[model samples]
Target: MPVIAVLVLDGVPGHQLTAPGLAFGTAARHHPPVAYDVRICTAPGFEATGGLASFRVETPWGLDGLADLDDTDTVLLPGHERFRDPPPPDVVAALRAAAARGCRIGAVGTGTFTLAATGLLDGRRAATSRRNTAELARLHPRIDVDPEGSVVADGPFHSAAGVLGGIDLCLDLITLDHGMAVAIETERQLFLQLHDPTTPATTCAAYTPPGSSLAPTTTWMEANLRHPLTLDDIAAHAGLGARHLTRRFHAETGLTPLQYLLRARIQRAQWLLERTEDPVERIAALTGLGTPANLRRHFQRQTGTTPTTYRTAFRTFVTNLTPRE
Candidate 1:
């Protein structure tokens, strides 16, 4: 069983605390036995409160309760407002010790601010709410704060943007460590959509058309995922040289044009795999990925499952659903 310690702070978002709890909390139900033990730890004088209704929560343990931080495999820091100020000396020491012992550390929203203050995020890829990006960057210039993605996982540390992104981060962890079936079931139990990290619009405003020469080229590739087009063709269609297109493409999307095109095609394949009854080879063809074997490789690489396994699980999920038919 994976033991998860969710470090709670006053004013922590209730949903952020509950998201990972619900996902990992239900692990036992997944394999017919519980696979995780989750605990909420707080500092002394800890009085947790949240919700529009505003309720107070009581915990039995204090920071000393996390004396076992060294033994914990994963530590979760949920969204909290007070993370701007460095954590108390004792808390910082505990966090530093946990990392030195090689525990996977995770932070959600401004909770990242707390983790950053521990000096553990230096040279690490991390993320926080857009509202706090400037502050995080200004405060910890050594930490790479990714403003675009909801979550950034650099080796042993993972950080997320906000409350909802917290859920996505947990799901990603479950999917990575356990399996996609566990992740999907957890999402179903929590009444949250199964998130795809590449679908940026769900958690972020769509990046506007930057009016670069690569703009129309990307737009065309997004629409033409079913067809194979060479990079030279894309450059010509965009009315730019290949070198110029590559430069502008990377600037606007933070991905080389080829990389962006591959991501778009893979996302399309995931959509079809989840929503349609198409055969794997057919889905591959439609997504411009060419072969079922190739599609399976990429699907597992991106989402931790093969096409057949995903479809089988999806079929089981549909069977369990109440039929509108």
Candidate 2:
């Protein structure tokens, strides 16, 4: 089993601190017989002060309780309220030592700041919340900060964009360790819809009010994703002129008709990739992308990876997870 050490600091966001446990723990439960052991660790004098508001949190383990870096598989750093300030020297030293010992390090939200301060991210790509991207880049000029990605992994170091992005990062780690099936099952248990990491949060919002003007047309588009769809077809289905439909769709969905269609198609393709073993050619045809080449181009642009690579990685992970009879 992998041992995960979550380092807690003063003013740490409660959600970030708990997210790793929830993700890994839930995944382990679904997989049967636990696969990971997670523990919260802090320095001897550490006292928990909640972020966003002042509240108290208590933990059972101190820094002395941590296993040697070689024994610990990963160390998670959760973002604290005072992210602008450098972490205590002891914590920084510990993290540096852990990295040197070949332990994987993960930073959640502004926890990237703490990780960057150790110079481990000096020449590596990292991610932080979009709101703090400029500051992160300005502070660490040698580090490549990706503003658009929700989670970024370069070697043994992984960084997540925001509080919720911590979940994405943990789920990704679960996928890497177990497989797509386990990750998808964990997501279902958590009541989360699997989303493409590269897609912006606003673009993934599926909020359509009951009486919204675009609801009916949007419904039709989903049902016809396998067909060769055109803007005119959407307009005709909605009983409106093409020009009028475009305007209303934009007003209601915050996306043009074509943009919404593309998003829908991408989502459908992701589902097929996760749930079926169909070849790229068949998947492309099923999702109305026309051909394998088109799917590769668009899927790479949307998710930052090729279809074959995605399938191989996910399937291989899952295959390793199957228990022996």
Candidate 3:
């Protein structure tokens, strides 16, 4: 089993600590076992303060538990109320040691500040809550802050933009560990939905007319990304005319029906490429791209890289995290 160490600190928000356990633990409950051994560790005398008024938390493991970096595959840092303050030296040291030992590091919300403090994020792309993006950029100009991305990954470091973005990041890690199928199953079991990070927000008052929502149709499309879908087919599914579907889809999702379908297919292809050892041709067939050449052309157009190159980089990162037996 892969070991995931969640490094806790004083003032850590309650949800941030619990989100990882819920995500990874739920995956472990799935058939065939996407197993992870997750533990919470903190410095001696450390206590976590919840964002709510009535809660405080204590973990069983201390800083000593983190000393053996070889036993850890990933370290997740959760944001605290005082994220602007420098992290404890002992905590910073352990994080650096874990990175040096080839463990992937992830930060949630203002926790990006904690990871940023270690200097490991220098020259790397990262994301944090939109409210704190300016401060993060000002404090660490060497680190590239992606204000628009919900999740940003640079080499071994990953950062998420908001409180809920942590759940997305964890699900993404689960996808990396097992496969898209496993992650999808886990999402269903957890009653969670995974949103495409690149999709523009549809909730803006200007875009969403009162009482009008494309959610039902979009949800259907997400569940059926493997099919070769056409505009008419989508229109019928949504109980609208083709022209009406195009207008509503563009207005709601900021993408035309075909554009949305293309992005959905590419997203599916990316998931398969990152998590499965399937060949490009097989992935193409699975994602409804028809053939390897078609998948390559579309993938390069969207991502500016070949599917093979993306797979190699993702697999290399995964391999480096797995300790030799």
Candidate 4:
């Protein structure tokens, strides 16, 4: 059984990820030869979108899982609300490596834009949501955008229109892997399972962060990344004791509060480096890194390169994607 690694980022839509997995699972049940070990892999330093109704997913795998993958396996990127932002360097690098290794890459809705950021779909005909087709074409002119294609397949790159088209894309992938009969059977099983009354509603309590959850607290931290915050300040915001907050925060995010804050600041710096022409000094101040030296030190330690170097490479990549006069 090959692994179907579904890469989800911040603000990942609930349905986009679930549909493909359910479809593949149903297909595998019908045809054992096409079994897939589906894994929901979260991006490094994954954070929630901080909506009142937003829930968290505890992903068993991270980007490190992609470092060693079977070429026969597939990597599917579901639509994330943050798709407009340039993907983190680690994500871009992982996808680039997977593409080079001959992995089948698929994207849905805004996910198409994220894949395009990798430049893998630059010259390929891809489809996204009907509304975003023109914006995608405007951003990545090298791509052959399909304004009306609900599900477009160009070489190894398969794309879907939106959340609704996700199942179609997965069935198409099943069709590519097996025969049409298996795909048809998979769809049938899926529909039956959906309408099955015996299938009980799964409790989301495990996924829901507790009332004391550090989710809202983390959102607060991100909002005040430029401010000078302390452990006591964070604990106060969360209404937990300092030591209690540390333990809870680490348990949830795998990082201590201060550690998470520093990393968040570094990610903020990365965002500024890629999206804006801000100098290191201003970025450092804005991210609460204090000074250029402090920013360079932490940035280099975390990113393995300097801030200016990262920005220059990003600009060069974007420039190459642009059509010149």
Query: lDDT, candidate 4, residue 188?
Result: 41
What lDDT tens digits, residue by residue, belong to model 2 across residues 27-79? Answer: 77755634888888875445665745566656677664454657448888888
**Under the 3 Å rule for N, CA and C atoms, how many clashes does model 2 have?**
0
Pairs of residues at least 3 apart in sequence or in different chains that clash in candidate 3? none
In model 2, how large is the Cα lDDT of residue 284?
89
Every model's TM-score: 0.59, 0.59, 0.59, 0.58
Off by over 4 Å in 4: 49-52, 193-325
True-structure lDDT of candidate 2: 0.74
Which residue pairs clash in candidate 1? 28-33, 28-34
lDDT of 3 by residue, 182-225 (tens): 56556544541225332211111111222347766765776787
Query: What's model 1's lDDT at 249?
Result: 76
lDDT: worst 10-residue window of model 4: 199-208
Task: State candidate 2's TM-score.
Answer: 0.59
lDDT of 4 by residue, 32-79 (tens): 556788888889757753235667887668997777776898899888
For every candidate in turn, the CA RMSD to the true structure comes to: 15.1, 17.8, 17.0, 20.9
Residues 112-156, candidate 1: write the lDDT tens digits.
Answer: 998999999998889987678878999999998897647789989
Query: What lDDT is reached at residue 312 by model 3?
Result: 67
Backbone clashes for every candidate come to 2, 0, 0, 0
- Candidate lDDT values, in order: 0.71, 0.74, 0.74, 0.77
Candidate 3: list runs displaced more than 4 Å: 192-325
Candidate 2: stretches off by over 4 Å: 43-45, 52-54, 163-165, 192-325
Q: lDDT, candidate 2, residue 249?
A: 78
